[model samples]
Target: MAFEPLKGLRVLDLTSVVVGPVCTARLALYGAEIIKLESPEGDLMRGLGGQSPTGRHSGTYLHLNRAKRNICCNLKLPDARKIIARLLETCDIVVANMRPQALARLGLDHETVTRAYPGTIYCLITGYGLDGPYSGFPTYDSVIQAAAGIPGLVAARDGEPRYVPMVMCDHVVGEIAASSIMAALVERSNTGKGTFIEVPMFETMANFVMQEHLAQHSFVPPVGPAGDQRLLSADNRPVRTKDGWIAFTVNTDKQVQAFLDATGKGDLKADPRFATVRARADNVRAWFAL
Candidate 1:
C-alpha cells in the first residue's frame, strides 16, 4: 500500500514564502490537510519567484503550495481573530516562517499557540533562532548562503564569491523543517503531548557547511586550516571529454581504481599519492588533476 501516515491531520500553514511552504508541502504530500493562511497582499513568492501565465501563481509558488488549501486573512484587523481562532481549533499542527515579532503580534507564536492549544504541534522556521543576536533580522536565500559560508567556500575554490544560482538555503532549511515536524509528531504520539520545534536557517546551514569543511580545524588546537582541501581544489570539477563535459566523483579505493582504469590511467593506481583515500586526501590537487 502507498504510505500516507499523516492522513487526516490538519496543518495550519502560517507562512508566506519558500521555507514555510516547503515544510507544509511535504506534510501535504504525506496526506495532511494543509491550510495555507496568507495575508491580503498574498505570498511574496507569487510575484518574486518568476513570471507565471496567470500572473498570480509563479512556478515556484505553485510547486511549493501544491496539495494545500489557502485562506486570505488580514490578521491586523480585529475581525480576523475569529477566523484564526477557528482554524487553530481544527488544526493539528501549525507551521510558520514569519519573523518572531510578527507571529507574536498575531498571537501565532509558539508560546501563544501552544498555550491556547496544548495538543497542537508548532514548528517555527526562522532565519535565525529567537535567542540569537541576528534574531528577527530580514533574510533571504542569498543572505543565508553568505552568512553560512557557501559563497566563501566558492571563493576559496574559485577566488571569487558567488551566490548559488537558486534558493538552495530555503529548500534545504524547508526540508529540514519538515523532518523536524515529523519527528515532533512521532514524539507527540508517544507522549500524548505536543511539541514546539524551531528550525533556524542560518544555524542549520552553518552546521551543514562545517560538517564537511571543518576538516582538521575541528580538533581543539587547530592542526590545519578549516575547509576541505579536496573540495576547495579548483580542479575538483567537471572534466572535458571529447564529446562534451563529464562530472563524476570517485571517493572509495575501488571506485578510484575503476575510474583510473576506465580513463586509461590505471598505472596511476600504483602511485603513492593516489593509491588510497588518505593518500588522495594528502595530495588533493594532484589527484583531482587526474
Candidate 2:
C-alpha cells in the first residue's frame, strides 16, 4: 500500500478551472478526501480538451480531477449555501480560484470562510494580487505567460513573441499553492489556528522568470543587463550533429575547458576572453561563435 500522508484530512475544493483543481488534485493524491464543488452545468474543463465517451468528462478534466468526489451546487440558492456551510464545518481546507469579486459575492472569500469556520485553512488563487490595478482582472494561462515576460523572452530568441505552448503558469502556481497549503496545514497542526493564503499567478510567474533572467540587474547600478546572455543567445539551442542533435550547456570554467578539449580546441581555454566566468559572460556571443 502507498503512504497516505493526509489520510483523514478533508478539502472543500471550490475551484473549477486549472489552478485550483491542480492544487486539490495533488492533495487528493496525498490521501486527502477532496470534495470538488461544481455547478449544475459542471466545470468548464469537463467540456474542454476534446470529447469524452460520455461527452461530459474531457481528458484534461478527468486527469485533473481524478481521485476526488464531485458535487454539484448552485451557490445562489440558500439550500446549496447551507450545504456548503455544512461541508466547510468539517473540511480542513477550502480552496478557490475564482475572481475576487465573484468569491466575495458568493460569500466564499477568505474573510468570510475563516470567520465562519475557525481553524479552516482558506487558500485563494488569483490572476493578480488582491489590491492592484490588475486585481480581479480575468486571466488565463496564456495571458499570464505574456504578462510575466515569457513571450518576450521567446521573442528574444525566436524573433516573435510566442506563448510557451503549455499552461506553464497554471501548473507552476498550482503546485506552489499546494505547497503553501501544506505549510499552512502544518502551522495549523501546531497552533490550532486557521490561515489565509493568496497565490497570485502574475506575481508568482514574474518571480519565476526573474529568478534566472534577472542576472546582473539583480544588483543596484546594474552590473550588466537584465537577461542572462548565455540563455538568450540564439545559438544556445541543441547543436546539430551529422546524424542527430545533442543538447548541452557549458556554464562553468571547467565545463567550458572540458568542452574545448573535447572539440580539439583546448588552446581556446587559455584565451583571456574565455578564461573566467565573468569574461565568458561578457564575451558570450564571441564564445558561441567560436
Candidate 3:
C-alpha cells in the first residue's frame, strides 16, 4: 500500500476493449487494487491478437490488462448483482464503458453506484457525449474514425481519408479517461467526496483533434477549411528501407531545412516564399516538389 500512489485505492472495473481496460490497467499499475469485472465470455480483446506471453491470453488483452485481478461475473444473474453491489460498497472507484442501458440493467448505473456507495468515484466511458443526437448509439473505434472526418483527411491527398494505422483514438481517449479519474481521485482526497465523471471517447477524440481544424477561429482571416498544406504532401509517409519502414514527420522549418540539405536542395533556405512558417504552411506542396 505504501509503494503505490493509489495504493489504498479499491477499483471496481467493468470495462473492455482498448479505452476502459487501459484506464483501469494504468490504475492497477500504480498500486491501486483493481478488480476487473468481466462477463462469462470474458473481454472481447482476449481473442484480438493471436500471440501472447502465455497461449491463453492474447497480446491485446495482456497489454490492456496488467496488474489487475480478474473476476468473472455475469451481471444478468441476481447473485451476480448482489456480488457487484457488495464490491461497490467497499470500492473507491468504478470504471465502466458499457452502454447506459446495459449498465442500468445490471444496476451498475451512476444512480445505483452512488446510492450504494456515495463515496465511490464512478467514471463512465461512452462513445459519444452524454447529450447528443448520437448519444446512446453503440459505436466502435473504426466507426468513430469514419464519422470524425478522418477518412476525409486521408482522402485529401490523392487517397480518401483512411483509417489510422492503429487504435489511436481509442487509446488516446483511454488516456484522457485515466487522467480525469486520477484528477477526481485527488479532488476526493481533499473534499472527502467522490465525483461522477464521463469520458466519452468520440467527444474526447473530437476535442483532441479539433485543434487541427481550428483554422477559421485561430486566425484573423479564415483559411480554407482546416487543411494543413505541409501535412497535405503525398510524401508525408514513412520512408521504407530494404527491410522495414522508418516513420518520421517533417513539421518544423529546421527539420524541413535539414531534409532539404540532406537531399541536396539547400537552395530552398534562400527562397523568400518558403522561409516563413505561414509561407511554408501555405505552399508546402510546391516547396517539396521543387
Candidate 4:
C-alpha cells in the first residue's frame, strides 16, 4: 500500500494555468481527491506546450494535470454556481487562481466561500493582492518576473534585461502555495477552523529576489545600497578549468584558506581584503580577480 497522507481529503480546484493547477497536482500526488474544474472551452494550457496525438491535451497540460479528474462547467451560468455550492459542502479545500474580481463575481472569493462552508480551506492565488493599484491587473509568469525586478537582476549580470526561459515565478509561487495549504490543513486539525490564504505572485517574487539582494539597504540608514555586490558581479559564474569548467564557492575563512592553498595563492590569505567575509564583500571584484 502507498503512503497516502491526504487520502480522505477532497479538493475542488478551480484554478487554471500554472500556479493553481500545479499546487493541486502536488496535493493529488499526496492522495487528495482533486476535482479540476474547467471552463467549457477547457484550460488554455490544453493548447500550449505542443499537441498530443489526439490534439486534445497539450504536453504541458498532461504533465501538470496528472492524477486529477477534470470537469467542465460554464461559470457564467447560474446552474454552475449551484454545482459549486454543492461541491463546497463536502470539499476540504477550495483552490483558485482567478483574478479577485472574477472570483467575487462567481461567488468563490475567500469570504464568500468561507461563509458558505466554514471548514473549507480557501486558497486564492492572484497576480497581485486583492487591493491596491494592481489588484485586478492581468498577470502572467513573465509579467510577474519583470515586475518583481528579476529582469533587472539579469540586466545587472548580463547588461540586458531578459525573462528566464522557464516560468520560474509560477513554479516558485505554486510550490509555496502548496506548502502553505498543507500548513493550513495542519492548523485546522488543531483549531477545527479553516483559513483563507492569499498567495500573491508579485509580492512573493519580490520578496524572494530582494531577500538576498537587499544587502546594505536593509539597514535603517542604508549602509551602502541595495543589491549584493558579489551577486551583481559579471564574473560571478563558473570558472573555466584547464579541461572544462567548474563551479565553487569559498565562504568561510577555513574554506577560503583551503581554496587559496590549493590554488597556490596561499600568500593572498595574508591580505586584509581577503581575510574575512565582510572584507571580501567590501572588495568583491578584487577578491574575484584574485
Candidate 5:
C-alpha cells in the first residue's frame, strides 16, 4: 500500500527556486495533483547547472519537483493570465512566490482570487512578510540568514559572524509554509470557505529563533547568550578521530559519566565544578576541553 493523505487535491504551484517549490513538493509527495506553472523560458532552476544542453535535470531541481507536471506559460501576457484565471476557477489551491506588489499588479493576489473563486485556497510565499517595513524589499537564503542573526549566533567564539551554510533558512521556511497551508485547509473544511495565507521566510525564521533559541535571552538580565544549547557550541561539528571523524555527543550526566568511565575519567564526575547542569554550563569550555 502507498502513503498519500492529500490525494485528489489539486495544487497549482507557481513557485520557482528552492523555498516555494519545496513547500509544494511536500504536497505533491502526499499524492496531490501538483500542476507546476512555469514561465515561457521555464523555471530558471532548469538551466542552473550541469553539462547537459537542456540542463533540465538539475539535481537540486529534481530533488523538489519530482511529482509535479511541467507547464510553460508566459504569465506576462494577457493570454496567459486568462489561462490562469480559467484554471483557478476550478482549481482547489493556488500557491505562488511572487512579491506582494507584483502579485497585485498581475491580479493574482489573494483578494482577487477570493472574489473570483471563493472556494480556492491561495497561498503566497515571500522573502519578507506581506506587511511590515521590509515587505517589498528583495531577499534570498543567505540574505535572510544575515538579517535574522542566525549567522552571528553560529559564529566562532572569538571570530567574525559565520553563516550556517546550505541555505537552511529558506529550507526551514519552506517546511513551515507547507504545514501552514495544510492547517489552513483544515479550517476551510470546517467553515466551507476559502482562505489566503502569506508566508514570509524571514518572519518565520525570526519566530523560530525566538521559540527555540531566544527563550532564555528574551529578558533584560540575559540568562545566557542567544543561541541553541547544543549546536551553537564552538566545537559542535564532526570530531577528529585517529583516522577520520566521528560526530559524538554525551549530553546528559549519565551519558557523560559513561564516556568518562570508558575513558577512565569517571572520578571527575564527582568534582565540584562538574557536579550539576548549571555547573556544567558554567564550565562548558573546561568540560569540552576535558
Candidate 6:
C-alpha cells in the first residue's frame, strides 16, 4: 500500500515555472491531487527548460509537473473568474509563485483567496518579501542566488563569481515551501484553520548562506572574517585519479591519519600544520593544499 496521507486533499496549483511547481509536485508526490492552472500560452518552462519532441512540454516541465492534472484558462477574460471560483470552492490548498501585484491583478492574491475561502491553505512563493524595497521586483533563480551571496562564495574561492550551473535557489526554496505547506497541513488539522505561507526566495536563500558563511562574524565582536576559510579554499574540490575523479573528506584525527597513510603521505601525520583539527583549521589553505 502507498503512504498517501494527502490522498484526499486537492491542491489548486496556481503556479508556473520551477519554484511553485516544485512545491506542488512534492505535494502531489505525497498523494495530494494537484490541478495545475496554466495560462492559454502555457508555462514559460515548457519551452525554455529544454527541447521537446512536441515543442511544448520540455523535460524540465514534464519532471516538475509530473502526476498532476492541468487546466488551461485565460485569467484575463471575465469568465475565467468563474472558473477560478469553482476550482477554489473545491480546493484544499492554493500554491502560487506569481508576484504580489500580478496576483492581485488576477484576483488570486492571498488576501482575496483567504477572504473567500478561509479554509484554503494559501502558499505564496515570492522572489522577495511583501514589504521590502525589492518586493514585486522581477527576479528568478539566478538572481536570487546572486542576491544570497552564492556567487560571492565562488568568487572568494576562484576569484570570479559564478552561478551553481543549476536553478539551486528555486529547488531549495521549493522544497522549503513544500515542507512549510506540510507543516501548515498539520496545524490546520489541529486548529481547523488554514495558513498563509509566504516563502520569499531571496530571504530564505540569504539565510541559508548566512548560516554557513557568517562564521566568526556572527558575533558582535567579530573573531575572524565572515566566510569559512575551509569552504572558501581553492583546493576544496574533488581530486583526480588516474582513471577518474574521487571526492572524499577526512575531518577527525583518526580519519586524517588514515588518509595520510593511504595517500603515501604518512610523514604529514607528524607535521604540526596538519596534526590536529585546530591546526588544520588554522592552516586551512596549507591543509587543503596537501
On TM-score, the leading prediction is: 6
Per-prediction TM-score: 0.95, 0.92, 0.88, 0.90, 0.92, 0.96
How far out, in Å, is residue 282 in model 4? Answer: 1.7
TM-score of 4: 0.90
Runs in model 1 lying further than 4 Å from the true structure: none
Q: lDDT (CA) for every model shown?
A: 0.89, 0.90, 0.82, 0.91, 0.81, 0.92
- Please give the TM-score that candidate 1 achieves against the real structure: 0.95
Q: Which whole-number lDDT from 0 to 100 does residue 73 have in model 5?
A: 89
The total number of steric clashes, by the backbone 3 Å criterion, in model 1 comes to 0
The better candidate by lDDT, 1 or 3, is 1
TM-score pick, better of 3 and 5: 5
lDDT value, candidate 2, whole model: 0.90
In candidate 4, what are the lDDT values of residues 33-108, reduced to their tens digit? 9999999899999999789999998999998999998889998999988998898899999999988888888888
**Using lDDT as the measure, which candidate wins?**
6
**Collision count for each candidate, in order:** 0, 0, 5, 0, 0, 0
RMSD of 4: 2.1
Clashes of 6: 0
Error of 6 at 243 (Å): 1.2
lDDT of 3 by residue, 123-213 (tens): 9999887798887888888988877767777787658768888887788877888889999988998998889999887778777767655
Deviating ranges (above 4 Å) for candidate 4: 1-3
lDDT (Cα, tens digit) per residue for candidate 1, span 24-106: 89899889999998888999888876778778878888998999999999999888988999999999899988899988887
